[model samples]
Target: MTDKYVIPREKIKQLESLLNERDIDTLLIFSREGSDPILPFLIGEDTIHLGAALFNKNGRHIMLTSKSDEKKYYESGIFSKVKTYNTSMAEVFLKELNEINPGKLALNFSLEDAIGDGLSVGLYMMLEELITKDRLQKIEVSGEEIIRELCSVKTQTEVDCLRRCIQITNDIYDEVFTKVKCGMSEKEIGDLFVEGMKKRDVINGLGKPYDYPIVCIVRAGLAHRSPGDTKTIPGDIVIMDFSVRSEGYVSDIARTAYFLKPGETEPPTDIQHAFHTAYKAITAAINEIGPGKRGYEVDAVGRKVIEDGGFPTVRHSVGHPIGRQCHDSGTALRPLKENQDNRAAERKIQLMETYAIEPTVIQDGGLPCMLVEENVVIREYGAEILSRRQEKLYLITCE
Candidate 1:
């Protein structure tokens, strides 16, 4: 199929401005079997996964690949120029560097963001040796900020892909809710989700399939645990947190289901209260997001709601940017706690960025944990909720 994604030229221009401002004369992004995340944003294709893209201060770019992958690179029609090497990629790479002779070169490496740290230490050492042998200028710096911005900001095509993936996840949940019984085990319920994704020809956005849909059977603690054989019981609240990957984009969503006790038409008052409080928290947090808003400020809006509702504040962030990865790198809606790394939460939210707002309400005395997660896109005025939100709990009728 022909590629349907493109990094808008305007965005490329902005990236060039950022490189110029940082005094980075050139950037070198190397990928081995699609290891680097930033390569997809620029190349817009998965046909040739092994290659290198070089971008200069002028926003112009070139692609270098082996003879085997050169045809696909030409088919892409995205790169301005393409160079093919027969035997020695090292020789071609060294020749390119000598020709450009950049004063300051940037590579994909970061200490703060894991997504920007794709370059391996072993490869770095090899590159250093080559540069030293050639007696070339070796001013190397990390291109974390540039890669972060490129991956965080969504193009129209990316936004559409995310929307489709979210809709698929919603549909799967809607179908699973109708089939789930009061006696079903958590693992059984997770199997239904796996079948749904397979039927729809989609895959889990992150992590392995065994734990992708973190199924909680009336259990409370950390949110990343795997689903177990615990069977669903009456008066229990089950939380299903999952993500879907499609077209190289991801959507994260979570919903809670409450099982009705025998002869009971609805859940207990305490359960109802916890569910509403979590829903309210996520709603308020999403409303607080917009262009130029700080991440911590938005997090406080949701955190306060949970506190006022007589529940313990969640240990994790209220929300985080979602895109190429489930927890994509960018500004995060989190508190600036003392002696903690809160730099991601201190930055201002950018326009066209997407986030997953999840507010958790943990009850004391072994009561069920309530959590509601929703996806949103940062707009010029405010945030737009992309998922068909879980307005109320999914109540299960029991015999």
Candidate 2:
């Protein structure tokens, strides 16, 4: 099945409804040289380069583009009504805004969510300079909440894309884990993942290509650091967190494995304890996920499992939204710690939303670090796990 994207009409209707509820007359998704991340969601297929899509609550949706990008927009056929600008984007934007004459205009900007904050300051300054004071007053509000709501729920196509990408990631993990040995360096194993991506015609999902598939052997740190020359040894636990990008969607999964010494049938005691605790944490988190549940509530349930199991409480949240970007914006499953913004986690989880539930445990005194990340989509009843569930720690017996 193909993973090409097409924004469904229902999403447009949903956005319009949100705008109406907020008394927003129009939402301007503006970008320069196709720099804004929100542009792709409004204009389907990730093809449009430079343009502005004005979604008005009155069902009068229109797109504006420079003459250079006009052809690209038209060719995609995603937007039916397209307007063109001759030279100055700022001047043309003002003209179009004047014509639309919305009483309350919303721009894509946010202080909390990075993905929703795609409109750069430079662009905002240019827009501010061109528009009249009266017009500027109408543009007071940020459309970030609307954008987040629009992106949080996955359409069938988006869910399918994520599923396919996740399957490929799982297959690559299966292939690479089978070849891991007790003497191989962490970098060597990471290179195998790189090779797997190349063979599959996919790219790394989250950060710099080399930094991902985080290979943490034994007591190494659990940050997004690059793989190092630390060699795997017998009785050592290795944790790998990795993701792949395909069709503008990404998949995130982390697995833990233990290299057993000669004649050892399973992982050591401490390793087993940590792994099982993490597994139960993730399972509890998944069970807690459902429509109408709060994100922090879900996080708390998983967090309780780790603490009850006598492991160190993880510094990071239980999980994050995963979509076009690995850490996709909206409704994060995290705790409302002291002095932190709690708005994202406070939002109620909705059906069809996807998240990566990672219940991690980090220890200092000889016990292994464990991060168990699994992708799931919220259904009517509960969250459905997308990846092949890792019920136990993987055992690597090869010398």
Runs off by more than 4 Å, candidate 1: 1-14, 20-23, 33-35, 45-51, 133-138, 209-212, 219-223
Give lDDT tens digits, candidate 2, residues 328-351: 876878888788878888889998
- 1-399: candidate 1 lDDT, tens digit per residue: 115435544446656777898889888877777777666666654424347777888756777788777876676565677888876577878788788888878899998998788877766676777678344345787889988887788777678879889999999999899899998988899998998998898998878643448888765433578788888888888989989988778899999999999988878898889899999999899888999999999999999999999888877899999998999989989999899887899999998899999879876556868878999998898998889999899999989
lDDT of 1 at 236: 82
Clashing pairs in 1: none
Q: Which pairs clash (backbone N, Cα, C closer than 3 Å) in model 2?
A: none
TM-score of each: 0.91, 0.93
Evaluate all candidate structures by whole-model CA lDDT and list the values in order. 0.82, 0.82
Q: Candidate 2, 56: how far from true, in Å?
A: 1.4
Instruction: Report model 2's TM-score to 2 decimal places.
Output: 0.93
- Which lDDT value does model 2 have at 302? 95
In model 1, the number of clashes is: 0
